[model samples]
Target: MSAIQIYDTTLRDGTQGEGVAFSVEDKIKITRRLDRMGFHYVEGGWPGSNPKDLEFFRQIRNERFRQAKVAAFGSTRKAGRPADQDANLLAILESGVCTATIFGKSWDFHVYRALGTTLEENLAMVADSVAFLKSRGLEVLFDAEHFFDGYRANPQYAMAVLRAAQDAGADMVVLCDTNGGTLPTELKEIVTYVREALEVPLGIHAHNDGGLAAANSILAVEAGCIQVQGTINGYGERCGNVDLCTVIPNLVFKKRLACIPEENLVYLTDLSRYVSELANKSPESRQPFVGTSAFAHKGGIHVNALLKDRQTYEHIPPESVGNKRRVLVSELSGLSNLVYKYRELNLGPERDSAEYRRILNELKDLEHQGFQFEGAEGSFELLMRKAYNGYQKPFRLETMRILTELRDEGHVYSEAIIKLRVNDEIVHTAAEGNGPVNALDAALRKALEEFYPVIRNMRLHDYKVRVLNEKEGTGAVVRVLIETGDGRKSWGTVGVSSNIIEASWQALADSFAYGILKLKENGAPDAQAP
Candidate 1:
């Protein structure tokens, strides 16, 4: 199998996404992660654009990459200026990288109208830029901007641009679908033509405007392109760029191509999540191979069949992409569904017994109450414990009250008083915050911390609100999901109410209850049995 190179452009093109911004620190962290995942090349950023990119290139000197090379991205020098005197070309040399990638115009219209340069001058720009970068002892990749559409318009000039880069000592000539509107068949044809026209290696850079970036990239590879440039999660301008997450798995697992190390493939799912979290973007649930719901089974029949034979429902084993199979308990669950859920919790149901029906009924009731166990495994386990053994409560809610004062000047102050009983002791506390929910959380934690000091380490990491029944007007039901972390483990809890404040309070209370329950369980005398 031929080894294909993976070039990650997440720092440059991916940051062009709307509302997506990464600081210098974020860039360094993401680059280190991509390098560790065995990517062949990482385009840090355009060193001439911002101070952050300049600092990134400067500060990245001491780090050693095991498998990835760092590439600095920039545009070709001006049409008339000598490449040696162009500031953009000089910045690429000072970027402190061994590889430099420069994008030059391939479209005839862009060369004449946008650049205001003649065809011959544009070709000289492409050739001279590549030659100048190579003269500085740096490997160069020439990106043929808008190569596919330009080729479709004027194939002869497009071929000339590739020939110029080849003659200019470029290590590779990368054809770019800059406008992102090229179809797969067109990409295949043009890539084959360019591959035949160039002696140096060929590469592809595709966008996702038509949602064909990944498809076009793969077709280019099939047509003899050796390198693929893409972002991590398809983040870029407009629709986005080709997603490396989908491309890498497809090449290695489906196409039988060599790109990344075999061991690094197992970390793909984790790496995807890490990037998404750092970017503050939610990972798509239906994303191929690495999404949370990619291999999740919710229907009763699907769950039952998968329990007997996984291939009955799953297209690929979840573990193949470093994800775990999830049997979601819902209104559609059957006896086998409950059995699977119990087994996952390390519990067993009695044969033909009332406990099975009881658990099933409980799941249906919880689903009706808007407690989605599909994404809240911790809550599901709590429900199982309550149904099977009638587990003892960690703390009982004695009383809770919220007070909000709004002055004539529009200033508002909110306070909460919470009382709870742990074991036989009753504790009460009051606290103030910017909102009633925050105050309630603060007051409740204050009361619990006196008894369980470890509660100080727990915090609410994320909160999500959803309107369950929007047609109900003021009486519409809402669901709140709260994620809490205690330094080591994170769990999600959910609550539903007609009022938004009440819904938030319910979720917050569940978060604290779950944390206390986990602490008690870990501190129990029989905990050592595990």
Candidate 2:
């Protein structure tokens, strides 16, 4: 099969997703990144829709991509408006992009109700739009909006619309599953029929309302579509568009069809997360292929099978997509988890020794008390290290006190006093913060920074608290997960207690200890114990 073309619309259709908006700079950054990853086309946005999009086109005009062509997106000329005179078409021409993607109503229902125009008029709109763009020496991708629904309702009219664009010299006539209601089986059949009917190259643009956007796109490619249109992380209106992240891997690895270069495939997970960060959205941990938990093994049977052979639990090597296999230790974990993790961490432990069994029992008991280790590997590492002989703690906490009071100014004031034994010295510190936990963190850092200045580089990245039993309400046991980073990498530590303050302190202390250990491993001079 020929290589499939990837068209990314994250800056265009993707912004239609709720809470997704990008500055012009953000769009340009993404364009360069996509180009580096070898995407065929990047749809900048609809130039005529908003000032931000128009400004994006203006700024992007002076930029050059390595291999990817930037395309300006817009709708067909308005009803009764000449293509040359239409503002939307004129804006596309002014955008200075080499290619233009214009969507025209393909469904009879959309033509009458959405566009409020007759079928013949909509056909003329598509034809005129494409012919005009081609006349301007721009490659035209004529998007047949709602094509699948159009075909279902009025097959002849939908085919006629595609034919109109083809006759008007469109480079490709894209079929869009606008409502995202099409099934893979029927979608493949429709795409096959269209591929047989149209002379122009075929493309599939799918939405994920029915959760089959990736499946539908793959099936469409098998049915002879040469181009696939989607957004990074599947960002789009409502249920989202097809995720190029998911589709690209499946096509390259499973179908043996080419999309992005195989070497570039390793950066797929980073790209997905980078886009999510720029969009101010949390990465979906359960998303296939690129998700954090995609290759994580939790069950004992699964881990045991994986210990002997990874293929027993995984479909592909995690490294193939730039992801690592995670062996999580929990109450459900078997000795296999401990064995695998020991190998991973290079911890010395005999497989059949009493110490190993003791550690395993301790882990299970802690988990039974609501200590989750899957998301808190740093804490788990500390637990394993503590079991080692002749292990010395960097610091020992002596006492800590927190006081909070509401002042007359309608603000709460919190202070923490902490005492610690660091090496041979006694350190005492007091600090104030907006909250009790923050105050404690400040006090602890104030005490430790004198001995381990590496502690100064570490700060809490995220802190999450989950109630183990909500029925207990105020007295409920809480599990606190704290993520800390030292400007380079981050680790998570977990703590559980009925007292929220104690839980936070446990997680916080583990975070500091883990950060110090990591720094020492990396050869930081200040990371040594005094």
Candidate 3:
């Protein structure tokens, strides 16, 4: 619906994901981004839960948010405590957030077993929490925890709980799939019923245990809910909440529901990658709308069709989200795929030319040898340039050596020496590190840093090693993908070898080469992204 609102819980529920721990500064940073992105609500955190969240509220007070309303989250008052005096409710008020959300029991079982209180007391807790918060000039939202399960068990009690909230003046009453097991159809039915009965605006907060969080949220909207609460990338406890990245695009484009301005949607991919980088997690390459591989074409027939009409392969234009179409080069690639790549890199070779055939054949040969060019766009570009432009090699390797030793106290140390020739000059360098790969990388960079000082800005971000054939055991050909960033944009290079060390070295060298080439071309291509 055009009246739909986007509520982001990334700072609160998102941190519940394993290995996700955002500092107060990080939360504030993300909050500012979301505000600029035009989210209607930003759930800061539970102030009573941790000092970090409390400090976030105090710190965010001075920062001006153009659009987002910072919301503090907490549970309803305890069974015996008064709403104004309860520590949890008081914390929400003291946080100075204009909006507060209080979660109360909607399930009969949790009321009797967990709270050791009557269902009537749970209802009082819900009503009083909302009413009390409203009296303090706070706009309150009430979360009916375990709403779907409670509805499935006793629809009457669930309705009563919602009525308690509605009568108490909550701005919105949210249905929570706390266990995340409800099917999309079930969610739709429950929400339809709630929408038909309640006069208050409805919201949906779904978890993705069944892989249906996004589907359920959409269905809930179709069934009449007007607000969607979710986390970026679906980051949360267990399977995470519905990913707003997927939901926002789905609503704005697919469903024709106005949530944010269409122009702002172009920043969707940029925001997704930015959030993942802040969390120090790689963006899922296959994630629906914003992932690297989402718009990538690999199969021969697919590429042929896509070249004629992208709609044959892509549901939406990649540029809609600030992502470009990627034609992955591999054994499965067809002539059309090579043509696309050649044009993208400005390689002056016609699709039917002999030079095009030569490069395509070489690519096939490389793929057969365990080279995965799909993730190594830099290496693939270098290959094309060398084949067609007679591009001179930037540097020559003279010699390299690495030694690993286990010393006293069970400590291990690695040392490396590298020798390189640049034109008429010879350069040599040595360095020690915690591992063989680290030492080699250090020495190689040291030798090259003098010649290309821009390499100093480049840092290795991620390294992944994959065995091509595990049946060959230790002798299996291994593929290494090294991701490097120069304080801004990141790129990858691939290397393959029977020796892990050799593979790592090849990838490392290519990574540096790619960084240098990119810097020479654009000075700093990624400064605007981060």
Candidate 4:
């Protein structure tokens, strides 16, 4: 099977998504990651659009990419302007990129009403832009904006636009569903038409408004399109674009069509998560293939089936995409959950061992009181290790006090005093912060760093608090889920109490405890146990 070219639009189109902003350095890192992962092309941002993009192109020029070719993206020159004299085209040439992608009007409405130009003029703009870029000795891909909608309105005119690009020495003509309202069946038919009408290979760029972007992109490929354009996690404007994470596996594993190198497929999960981290967006757990919950099983029947044969519940091996199957333990979990977890945790306890029963009972009792363990793997792991493996504490908590006051700046300031003992050495520290949690976090670091300086890199990644008993008013029990990270990976710890402060302290302490255990196991330098 011929390989389908994977063109990533993350730096350009993906940034259009809400709350998605990448610094120049971020773009550079992502570009290098994609290149290393063996993507065919990465659509760098348009140099004419922003200074950050210009800087990115400038910075990226000196770096050597592994396999991916960098392509600069911009729109066709303004109506009635000569292609050579167009600032947008000039920016693409000046971007020092070997490839350029230029989008032009395919819909008659955009040509007549939006651009205020004739259909003939729009055709000339598309042709002249492609020819001009190609003349500069650059590979050019033409994006027929809203081609599906245009084809539905005037099939002749839309086909004419694609032919215009093909006649102008374009390398490929990509059909775009700009509004993302087209269905898969419609996209397939139009892609077939393009194959029959023009000699150029087709690419698909579909948005997710109709929840059919991935479907449409794949359907077009099955209809003979050779390239697919999308973002890592479907990051784009509005409903976002088609997710490449979903499409690549489908193409390679299901369709038996090669996209990225087989070895690079294992990096899919990490790439999806890395892009989300750089964008500062929470990874969607339910996202297919690369999500945390993609291969996670919580139900008894599913876990039993998974243990017997992973094929029973999972479509493919999670490791194929750099993901792992997770057996989430909860009220819904059963014996199979324990059995599966033992394989990973290497716990030596038998099915009905005293230690196993004790841990299980503790979990059930705590869960009965509104503690959720499904998302608190770090806390649960700490509990299991201490209960079964005789895990030792590195430090002992002595006492803590908090005081809140109104400052002269009309803001509330919180002060925390923390005392702890490490190896018979007592440390006391006080710190002030904008809030109680922040103050506690600072004071804990101050008191602990003297003994466990390794914790200096640990920081809170996310803090979520939920009320468990709303009817209890101010005395309602609350659950806090604190996610902490030590620069590499993040883990969640949970706590429950009627007093929010006490609950927060529990979770925060567990987070630090987990970190301490990790450091001890890995043998951290300049740290001593109490």
- The CA lDDT of each predicted structure is 0.85, 0.92, 0.89, 0.90
Runs with alpha carbons beyond 4 Å of true place in candidate 1: 349-354, 487-489, 499-502, 518-530
Tens-digit lDDT track of model 3 for 1-530 = 54789999999899999878888888999999898888999999999999999999999999998889999999999988999899999999999999998899999988988899999999999999999999999999999999999999999999999999999999999999988999998789889988999999999999999999999999999999899999999999998989999998888889988797778888889888888978878688999889999898999899889888999989899899888889998998878888888888886646565666778889999999999998888788877878777765567788988899999999999999888887658888899999998998899888877677767788988899999999999899999999888888888899999999989988888887777777777855432211
Clashes of 4: 0
lDDT of 4 by residue, 1-530 (tens): 35799999999999999999999999999999999999999998999988999999998899998789999999998888999999999999999999999999999988998999999999999999999999999999999999999999999999999999999999999999999999888789878878888889889999999999999999999998899999999999999999999999999899889889878899999999999989999999999999999999999789888888889999999999999889988877666776677667776745565545566677788898988989999888877777777875666789989999997869998999988887778888899999999999898888887667888989998899999889999999999999999887788999999988889998999999898877776777744443
Worst 10 residues of 2 by lDDT: 385-394
Model 3 TM-score, 2 decimals:
0.96
Instruction: Please report the TM-score between candidate 4 and the true structure.
Output: 0.94
95: Cα error in model 2, Å: 1.1
Best by lDDT: 2
Q: Write the per-residue lDDT of candidate 1 for residues 1-530, one digit (tens) a residue.
A: 35999999998999999867788888888889888888999999998888989999998887898878999999899977999999888998898999999999999989988999899999999999999999999999999999988898898998899899999999999999998999999789878877776789999999999989999999999999999999988889999999999999889888889898766888889888888877889788888889888888888888878888999998767787788887888888888888887787775555464779877997898789777776666677777877776765567779888999997789888999888887788888899987788788899888777666777889988888888888988888888888898977778877788877778876777777777778776894421212
> Each prediction's TM-score against the native?
0.93, 0.97, 0.96, 0.94
**Clashes per candidate (backbone, < 3 Å):** 0, 0, 0, 0
Look at candidate 2 and tell me the lDDT of residue 77.
93
Kindly report which residue stretches of model 2 are placed more than 4 angstroms away from their true locations once superposed.
349-353
Output candidate 4 Cα RMSD: 2.1
